[model samples]
Target: MSAAAAATARDALRAATDAIHARLHGLPALQALAEGRIGRAGYVALLRRLLGFHAAVEAALADAPSLGPSLIPWGIDIAQRRRAGLIEADLATLGAALGASAGPVPLAPLPALGTVPRALGCLYVTEGSTLGGRQLARALDGLLPPGEAGRRFLLGHGARHGAMWRACCAALEHCGAEPARRAEMLAAAEATFLAFEAWFAGAP
Candidate 1:
């Protein structure tokens, strides 16, 4: 990639990251609830917002061509995994907080991949199943310019994922969750992003 294009990509990544952090800060009460530092209603509100914000992020990222292909799948995977892991973890934490264990609590499942809006598919190749890592990597390689811009974009995404994962961890930890469990969930989030990062790096 030319230096100018690389710079633009880097700037775009930074802008996205900033947007996400700003949203996180907007919900101080939710942050408190996730930490297990608030009331029942507050916790529920936080969870609701988290789910919505995650989807919104996906929708927004889907619009940026440089990020669209790589991020769409990453977003889908993270949303699904986070929905499942948080529900399991929340039930355990809430039960502990209330002094009782309970049956599995239900969560809103991720929107079926097909149900994802047509707008999101603008840059994606529609297919029956999820794209494998290798396929995604190849696609991104073709999209990303070779040079500093491509490298910076990959690094910026890695950094953004790290930041988002930390926010999730902070919320879970506040909820009286076990450290090990929190690590496991965060690891899954990291793995999803890292797969993309590796793909971008290995691209010709």
Candidate 2:
């Protein structure tokens, strides 16, 4: 595909998911957390939910090996991108800080990843989330105790965040080069966003 064609598919993805992406920002818990208005309990609850979401999504992506070809050449290492563990650790720290267990975090239900593009679509949502995580990490400065104990998930890949995101975007463009694959990716992306919104909204 030419540069112009690649740009168009990338734009198509952004255009398709833009509305739902905006809606995710409007989620009360997420909005409050982003604005630094959430208290300890609320913060913990938010992390618990996020842990569920990331844990499920990342696990599904891990099980899909076909994504390796499109991703590896772009420097996108799936293992390096796993964030559920960070979230789990953060929860443990928060729980320990309170002299209690974080308990079990339920996994958020996600759309089926039946194809490579569908799997990529799911990855797109989770990986792209790290960009916002950087800002959210800053918003959490005074919330967690000193050091990076409970905010590791938000801190994400730290300095590597930008590079990882760029690589992921490039991989996405490559996968979207084929129109059929692009449609599958877009549909799955939309489904992922909707599922996320529903889960975060307290729906089962």
Q: What is the alpha-carbon lDDT of model 2 when measured against the actual structure?
A: 0.79
TM-scores of the candidates in the order shown: 0.29, 0.86
Error of 1 at 141 (Å): 43
Question: Pairs clashing in candidate 1?
Answer: 1-146, 6-149, 35-174, 35-175, 36-174
lDDT of 1 by residue, 1-204 (tens): 431232332232223233333443334553453343555555444434333333333444444455434434434333322222332344344342223363322222232222223222211211101122123223334433443232221122332444554443333333214334333333333332333233323322
lDDT over C-alpha atoms for residue 58 of model 2: 77
Q: Model 1: how far is 110 from its true place, Å? A: 12
TM-score of 1: 0.29
